[model samples]
Target: MLNTFSLVGINMGGLKISLLGSLMCIAVLPACVGLKPSVEEQVNARIEAYWQAMIQKDYEKAHGFLSPGFRLKVDKFVYRNRFAGKTSYKAAAVDGLSCEEERCQAAMILEYTVHGVPPYGFEFNRTEERKELWVNVEGEWWLLPKK
Candidate 1:
């Protein structure tokens, strides 16, 4: 008993089989070939965006980058006050990033100018290096709380 169809000289499920194979390849090929950027790259991009939000003095936007757990422990008001009018970055960079599964660690360098000083009466620039941890939550990457 033959239960298969043929089309255009192809057999055994014919166009249906061909279409299914094509869809399978489309779904799985990228994962096999590593077409997507490395996890580190993705983590670095998230870290960069987070810093950019801070540099722009958009505390509300920056707070969005924190992990759900961190947000639960620290509310918006506390987060905003932590950086409000006290920090301004001239430049920022992600020096390194490493990740395993949903967890990532990043080293970041920020060049910033502090705006007010009682003695100096003028802004002074400084460079600071810090390490940040990140987590992938619900398909989105977020910064973890600092230790």
Candidate 2:
């Protein structure tokens, strides 16, 4: 036989667990319910995620972040060829960004390794600043290909 107690027909142990769960929910729900990421933050996150996919050589994942028009024009093969293995992106940080007219320009500092440089033909580390254009596509931000 199990040792059990109840209050108001609720098992004591189950009630305690339920109370803890309810309290945890009350404590956590506010943080998730009302706090929405600003456009800048969302776009910045997208930019960072894109670069992370690039760093991992996951071109397909990276391509999914591009605008529909861009994707329609540039297939996965072309996208892969355009960006694959040109440089190894070690890290990328969106240090500067601005949003206007439903579009965003993200200026990021990229730490990358380049291979086959002139003369030495050896790999080198370069930190470069680049800006990417992102556009709103059906309420989600997407990368726009430069024409």
Candidate 3:
């Protein structure tokens, strides 16, 4: 009973509505009915994601995990240079990750091997201490300064 152009317009409107509904579902589903992840969990996830990003040389993604103050002082190029390409530095393996909310300290040891002179294959393991701070801003925990 409908003319061809009218039918086409109706189909187009329906398609747009369907697309908007899909987008709204995707956007809102994760935000409802949850207490939201805790600070420690968020930090751990960020650290893991950061390491993965670093391993893949995804500097932009890795930079997101850094504190805002740190990010402001250091650019992406500087961050990449500091972390990438160390002849002495092999790879980092995280172990025994723990978080203390009261102390605001997340502890993890990076297992790594450094190349030695003459014999480059000599494997050695070292644990490096990393100190990270967590601050809450506007009800969201960020790995950044409070101010």
Candidate 4:
């Protein structure tokens, strides 16, 4: 039987086939490209923000970036008491900072002179310092204790 709903030179059977193919292509289009931001980019931004804040000694700013459990583990007062007052020893530079998924760690090289009295006198020294490890939880990151 000949159908009246034919497309151009093609018969009805071919027209139905072409329509189905077009529909399938449209359905699969979204899977071919991404619309959301990449996880790696998000993680890297978090790491940079944390690093900058720490270097600036903006403890509150840095603390705001931490995960909830970590924030509770040590309050603002404790953080200030532990790190705020101490003067920087100087000659320290961040050697490396890397992050993988929810975890990050950094290394620093410190160069200074050890001051001594009497026998030892003052001497120059250089050493590599390692910062504590950090972890992310529920989209927030925090520094873990050194072991």
Candidate 5:
């Protein structure tokens, strides 16, 4: 037979546990909310950084943006060589980006000056639009290899 005082103490203990649990959730919930940038923003930022690295001829840094699967398929040497001696762009912009779950696609526009041969020598500005694929792996976004 439990005494009245003992029953009251047990009830208080349960109440204290419940109160502590609720307080813990209250303290932790906000920190988990809005702690990271949205997926679209993150993808766009990563793409921007990749283009910047390329423009600066930092092949090693640009290679870091490639997806793990892509990197596995194509080593850094091959990746760098592909872009070596490529046409240089005067400006680049990420026109738009859309994300769905773990995958994202971005549209980019690059502006460059095309130089003609000496005989027909003429310089003209050209713009090209490209679609890029990206994937999110373990919370970090990476660009997929070009097909």
Candidate 6:
């Protein structure tokens, strides 16, 4: 009793074993090698995107990154209102991150430029490190905004 199959366009017979198992392994190797990013990478990517949204002043977009729990409590209108008229975000970048299980803390640097304070025509640039917590909920990483 033997099964026949083709491998690399070559037909082989009289072998009791099929190359199907080998082919399946080869097809699935990429998944084992991580077709999707690791947890840390996912959190880091989300952190970067969240800051980019804030930098773009797309509060609605940034709001989308907030944890589901937070979103449920704060509507987009309130979230968007929190940033209205006050301008400070010039740039943002993820500096470091640590993760364990379903939680992560991301350290980011926020850049700012402020003008007309104390002096009528003086402007200043500032940068600060900000830490944000991210959590995995329903297999998706989202920012955990402080309520």
Per-prediction tally of clashes = 0, 0, 0, 0, 0, 0
lDDT tens string, model 4, 48-136? Answer: 45545654667777677666676788776776555554422223333456667777664544433344435856544434465656677
Candidate number with the higher TM-score (1 or 3): 1
lDDT score, candidate 4, position 81: 57
Give TM-scores for every candidate, taking all chains together and pairing residue i with residue i. Answer: 0.67, 0.71, 0.51, 0.47, 0.66, 0.68
What local lDDT score does residue 40 receive in model 2, on the 0 to 100 scale?
67
The candidate maximizing lDDT is 2
Off by over 4 Å in 1: 1-36, 117-122
What is the C-alpha local distance difference test score of candidate 2? 0.66
Please give the lDDT score at residue 55 for candidate 2. Answer: 73
How far residue 111's Cα lies from its native spot in candidate 2, in Å, is 1.3
Q: Scored by Cα lDDT, where does model 3 land?
A: 0.45
Which candidate leads the pack in TM-score?
2
Q: What are the lDDT scores of the predictions, listed in order?
A: 0.64, 0.66, 0.45, 0.48, 0.63, 0.65
Per-residue C-alpha lDDT of model 6 across residues 50-77, encoded as one tens digit per residue: 7667767789998999998899999888
Per-residue alpha-carbon lDDT of model 2 for 25-127, expressed as tens digits? 3466433367765676567557756876877778999999999999999988898987565666666655567789789987766677787557878888777
> How well is each residue in 47-109 modelled by candidate 1, as lDDT tens digits?
656776777777888899999989988888899987676657655555556678999877666
Question: What are the root-mean-square deviations of the candidates from the true structure over C-alphas?
Answer: 17.6, 15.9, 16.7, 22.3, 20.7, 17.2
**Candidate 3 per-residue lDDT over residues 71-134, each given as its tens digit:** 7887778877664544222233233334455323444334334434354656454546555555
Q: Which stretches of candidate 2 lie over 4 Å from their true place?
A: 1-33, 117-120
Task: Provide the lDDT at 77 for model 2.
Answer: 87
